[model samples]
Target: MTELKKQISASLRKDLEAGELILPSLPEVAMKIQEEVKKKSSTAHSIAKVIMLDPGLTAHFLKVANSPLYRTQNSVQGLPEAIGLIGINSVLNMALTYTMRTMFVNTEGPWKKVLIHQWNEATELAAIVAVLADYLPNFNSDHMMVAAMLQNIGALPLINHLQHFPGLEQEEVETLVEENATKAGLALVKLWGLGKSFEDVIKARHDWMYESTPELDTTDLITIARYHYMKDKQRLEDCPPTSEIAAFRHLEELDFTAEMSMQWIDSAREKIRAIKRMLCM
Candidate 1:
């Protein structure tokens, strides 16, 4: 790397390691929902009660219930109806993901352009990963969805630093520092008390070899989700080959060409678009 890049990375690493950078906290609703979900005795009615306290979240849940993903026999016009149509777990995860997305919408900085792009990419990837659970056995779509949404959260503080510090600008050095975002994000999420599965997905998602375990994991979802994003941008040059994605390599065996991949993204885009509209409204 260049001298300036090296210096920026070193400086960021030092600050991050020394706890000088303040990472953003998970949204309160997400925390509360997680707590509620973890309780073995919690029921749909109980979770809905906490969620109903947040008008925006309740609205989003109702909207998602009406989304094509669920494809209900009829429209869902209320929280109780949504909960009934889409199971408690599914609605809970959607609410949690929407809360995180809303949390970062107000961010501004030198990295705002980068951050928005990354967020959109992540949101789309999260939706894709969630849907992939239908085809990929033993995969936890909820974990993958949340992992894809949050894997780059470390960049939030980095963006704040760049905005507050006049010395930093969008240069090659800054770009390299951006690449270190994943590491910073993993650390921040751990600090926020995220589960081990999400951390594993964040850590291994971009690796060349899909770690072979007894079951499907978030890494596989992230790998495929990223590919979907790149495919949308026609950004083959920006990513590793299909061989790098364990899932993609296998899909290739089933005659999944690049064109077919983009088509899949088209399907994913509809899901993402619907979700984004539902959340925003």
Candidate 2:
């Protein structure tokens, strides 16, 4: 790393560790949904009522709920029915994901393209995670989707800061953003009180080959999902095949083969596309 990168990285780490990082604040609706989701007594009706208060969000939720992705034989007419179809966990993820989506700075900013690129990449990985998790009955695809959606969150603050450093080429900007993203990401996850599990997933984003317990976990699913996403994007520079990936090796229940991987993606393509459409909307 250059001196500039080293200094920024060290400063970010220190600030985050000290709980002094200037993490972005969550909007009130996002905060309310997050708090409501944490309550044991929270229900679809109650959460729906809260969501209903925001006319715009209500419209968006209903649109997403009725979209082909979540559509069923019966149409979803309101928040309560939407929640019923999409589930409470997904409702929470939707709110959080929406929160991230709204963080995009004004369109005129120099970093707009970078922000959109990173955000779309995150959502695409999230779509992949959602579909991949569908194959394993034990995993909640909704939770995994949220985990994957947050993988690039650290880049947000880096992009925000880049507005001040304009003459740097895109490559230098990318290096700066990636090098300091983890520190910002860790602080954001904690600041948002998203739970320790999320914190673990955030840390694991950098460890593509990390392996843990014999049983599979959110982190393992994310590692595999990210690897596949990279492969699909043709961005997997030196990443090994599934046979050589630790997460793939560790998650024995998958028994994933190269051919099986391709087959799974093929079958899940529509579901994945629908999810990406919903998210991008």
Candidate lDDT scores, in order, read 0.68, 0.76
| Alpha-carbon runs more than 4 Å astray in model 1 | 1-6, 140-142, 171-177, 210-215, 249-269, 276-281
Q: Which one is best on lDDT?
A: 2
**Deviation in Å, model 2, residue 168 alpha carbon:** 2.6
| 15-133: candidate 2 lDDT, tens digit per residue | 66777756777778888887887799999999988887778778778877787556778777878888888888788777776677677533336767777887888888888888777
RMSD of each: 3.4, 2.5
For candidate 1, write residues 147-193 as lDDT tens digits.
Answer: 78776666677776667554545665257435667677777778778
Q: What is the lDDT of candidate 2?
A: 0.76
Give me candidate 1's TM-score against the actual structure.
0.82
Give candidate 2 regions above 4 Å deviation: 1-19, 105-108
